[model samples]
Target: MGEQPILEMKNVHSGYGSIKALKGVSMKVMPGEIVAMIGANGAGKSTTLMTICGIIKATAGEVWYDGKKINKLNPEKLPTMGLCQVPEGRRIFPRLTVEENLILGAFHRKDKEQIKKDIQYSYDLFPRLGERRRQEGGTLSGGEQQMLAIARALMTKPKVLLLDEPSLGLAPIIIQQIFDIIKDVNKKDGTTILVVEQNANLALQAATRGYVMETGEITLEDKASALLENPKIREAYLGE
Candidate 1:
């Protein structure tokens, strides 16, 4: 068999109350690979990421990380296991300074020295954050806030990073910058990433493989290059 995947969801069924958002969805991300989940609104892309991060509990099926089932783990427990998520809409603390917000990302850890090192690492990763370290999170531009959010997530030292809609509402140039940083993080830190995005073109360009979800089901799975050339994807998502 091929090398075991770093993260796997097998026939996952989850939703709010009785509304099923994910129906038997199964996907995997191998170590050091950037995997993209692309779909339109209400396609269950965000739900998949939330379920994986334990923000939304899976009512059925299994989620496995490092060969162990984690469907029932609480969200607070996930960070300790090296699973972190930078949720949709940069959820930084508007009232807190940039430095403080980043520190909160490591709340579960007790190693102050290591946390300080990680903080410096985040600054190295996003120099803009370092420049505005004392500024309130709400004062930063959208792109800057997004960078802080990503940097904060990294403070947890995650092995599997789930990024939800990282380019939600940003300029094309800023979006390009974010994608570049994501690839850099993957390449340099060996962080396995599972990204949910509506920007199919950019997402496919950055990822090694991708899955297309429609109405809570994965309708297509292929190498990023293959999906980029797909006629249906071009017509529907690529706006060709």
Candidate 2:
């Protein structure tokens, strides 16, 4: 097996016009690892993911994925490279049926048989989505919408899944369930995941390793278990 990380960002700086969000942020996600980025609101966690996925142009530094420099690639082409994001706010198409939303994810692929199988796998991963396969995405409850968002991304058959705020606006029980499913997806599919989460305690628990971001920079990174036990991490993020 190759030694390079599935995804790597080196000194990436990006943001909207005249607003720099990520300032020299560097991180990596190795194949099959569930890596979490945790921080408070406006810490630039989502910005890092967007830069890696090519949604926002990196004004400086490099983004490497699967042993290649992809900083200049278009966002539309990243999915074909096995890089996909389940963006924040559960951005499922409100007017589209759950199945249609899923179909949209695989629009780039030509493998009919595998796509069908993956669609069924999504249903298996989220049974509630299957129950409402033909229902409009907007009709689903908050938790269900979150599930659909994740399932839709999975349908792309990504090698690395970038999940931003997967637990946002979710009930505690639903958050637990979502984390469980995320863990299962990583374990079973061997998908490398880079997750930005506000729920630091839960994110650390589910991750193999984690990076703590503050402002526009990465402030701490370690084994998730070690980070969880860190006094500073507990004091600031874990609410202890």
lDDT of 2 by residue, 1-240 (tens): 248888999999999999999999998888999999999999999889888888899999999999999999988898888999999999999999999999998888899999899889999999998999999999999999999999988888899999999999989999999999999999999988889999999899999999999999999999999999999999999999
lDDT of 1 by residue, 118-232 (tens): 9999899889999999999999999999999999999888998999999999999999999999999999999999999999999999999999999999999999999999999
Ten contiguous residues with the weakest lDDT in model 1: 1-10
- Which pairs of residues have clashing backbones in candidate 1? none
Which candidate achieves the best lDDT against the true structure? 1
CA displacement after TM-score superposition, residue 235 of candidate 1 (Å):
1.3
- Supply the TM-score for candidate 2: 0.97
lDDT of 2 at 70: 96
Which parts of model 1 are misplaced by more than 4 Å?
none
TM-scores, one per candidate: 0.96, 0.97
> Which residue segments of model 2 deviate by more than 4 Å?
none
TM-score, model 1 to reference: 0.96
The residue-level lDDT of candidate 2 at 32 comes to: 92
